[model samples]
Target: MTAAVDVRARLVDRLEASGVLTPGWRQAFLDVGRHEFLPDVFWASTGDGYERCDRARSPERWLELAYSDVAIVTQWDDGTSSGQQREPTSSVSMPTMVASMLRDLDVHEGHKVWEGGTGPGWNAGLLARRQGAHNVVTVELDAVVAAQAAANFRALDIAPTAVVGDAAHGYLPGAPYDRGILTCSVRHVPPALIGQIRRHGVLVLPFAPLFGGGAVARLTVTGTTVTGTTATGPFTGSSAFMRMRQQRYQAPPVDDYLPGDWPGDAVREYTTLNPLNVVDDWLASFVVGLAVPDLYYRRSNNGGSGMTTLWLFDTGVTSWATVDFVDGASRFEVRQSGSRRMWSEVEDTVRWWTAAGRPGFERFGLTLEGGEHRAWLHQPANPLPSPRGQD
Candidate 1:
């Protein structure tokens, strides 16, 4: 226990030095140590895939993982699989990310905070300590995970109202909260959460679009709308959090997209744009995703030859395009099909991005009004032209 405490102190100091752990959260972090909430058997994807670790079998190793900056997976396949398959469904996020989100939360005394996901209850425990347990309400989707978190909270001698249900819907009974935060990322901000926060109340969450790449955002509620910018200050960083249960993607049948005669009837064309340019950078993925919301992509290469194919698919199943790149060639060939000109859209988005000097995530923002969302640049008034517009 003494060793654990020393390790915790070391971690706090490390994160504080990184500027993510501010003075406001120092004591709360110390008071609500992570080891107490984490389960005895958890998974850590230290390398390629999820690997299980048992505290009883190797206390020293478990302690090292608990105190380290990496995220610790507590639940696998949402509690459906065991021993064989090891895909993480729930976890305690990295300490630095937790601290960064908390700092952006900017909670004050007497404020009520609604937490979206209660994985292991460590974050909720920190919140409870910072703002009396009664002031924190946490919601989790899985009943078993929620029960375990409840038990963990009791063991730690902190009590926060823990609900077992969909966090995307949020906790309505405890409405009119002063602040709200989500451990999980969302493609769309739920209307219930926007309605629950009082005017001027802040809501901090990770916003992940359907395509790829994501970042945390801090929005303020006003009237029937909420508007804010993606987090950009020093401590802020990128995220790949699990999607809200309701927002999880259910990809269409592979056969439907790619018939036995794949690329059949696709209109082939050529352009000077290099396919490698957009796929290599997260910022490029984000910008292209904003411009083309309904599209997702896959890339593959031909053996040994410096040639690759970029396959694009529409979430709506209405369009598909494949861009092929060959070595030492300034131009590329694109085969596109369906009602939407998917390749043309990609080309236009890339063109616009280059014209704008290739802006970063901080230059982007979102505004939600009555459940409708619109992505914009610099400010809400300067909205980005929707993909729905003709190429």
Candidate 2:
């Protein structure tokens, strides 16, 4: 056997041992190799930026990258650049994540499946394997990426219908799907998805709020409403993903937050809670973001100083908060301006979270009804408090 095939086998063995690939998905996992759908050139994230990997220049390295458990960027800036740029618009996610999602999907034979964000067709191929090829429909908003995915499907002899359009507007022709899965993240569950799914159908999508953190949600559609809990257990780390094209974040300029005579009317105070202890934890941040809607933050460290400043802002640009953290200090200084008192809201959330025993993301659930979404902790009957000061 070739080296590439050997690497692929090793990966399958690893996944199988980890219990990520159950018996139901083992055949599909072994049959569909991720390397087949990948292009000659792709980008790998290096934390700070992405590095390009070319097949021709280094076939061995390429195979190592393709077989390894890492997300590869297939397109940059929506296919405008030639994979040289660090900004990735579309990617083939790591095998571990894909496997976990498929296991959670729990699709049955002959079930019609709908997939959003068909980057390179690897995921589509896997779905087609589980559910017949004719029953799987995948959508991509980027025309170029959609075409490429279609071509990849064809090359692999798979016949899943690929659509080029906004994923938010799902494929209407293939409505009433038994299952709906999104490869990318969304600020909220799309209303169209709920309308398209049949009653009792399951929809899994990455729920990312406007703030910082996110989690994978599995909700069951019931007529026009949908409800489910987060599947983010301790084993799974934060599933932060690239936002869907339409749901990408757009933040106001820093100058807008700090205008002439900044802090002119800002109120100053001190808090015992440390910003690092709150915002740094992924679970805490996700809960805080859910409780505080339209809230976003940024952090900066002073050069050569043992201090960091966390700045919070709202979507309206009306309310703002700043917390300065001093190294080895028991307390931090906080300043707030405008009507919202963003700092107070975040502090209250942190306190409530601690009082509640610091629930994990899995403890949170979401409900969508009549075009509105409600986040709840533990159960749907008890809704999470809204930052708008509503119960």
Q: Best by lDDT, which number?
A: 1
Error of 1 at 131 (Å): 0.5
- Error at 338, model 1, angstroms: 1.6
**Model 2: number of clashes?**
0
lDDT of 2 by residue, 242-284 (tens): 8988887788896787686767678999999899887888788
RMSD of each: 3.2, 3.2
lDDT of each: 0.83, 0.81
Quote the RMSD, in angstroms, for model 2.
3.2
lDDT value, candidate 1, whole model: 0.83
Q: Which stretches of candidate 2 lie over 4 Å from their true place?
A: 46-51, 81-86, 225-237, 254-259, 303-306, 387-391
Residue 301 C-alpha lDDT in model 2: 96
Model 2 scores what on Cα lDDT? 0.81
The best candidate by TM-score is 2
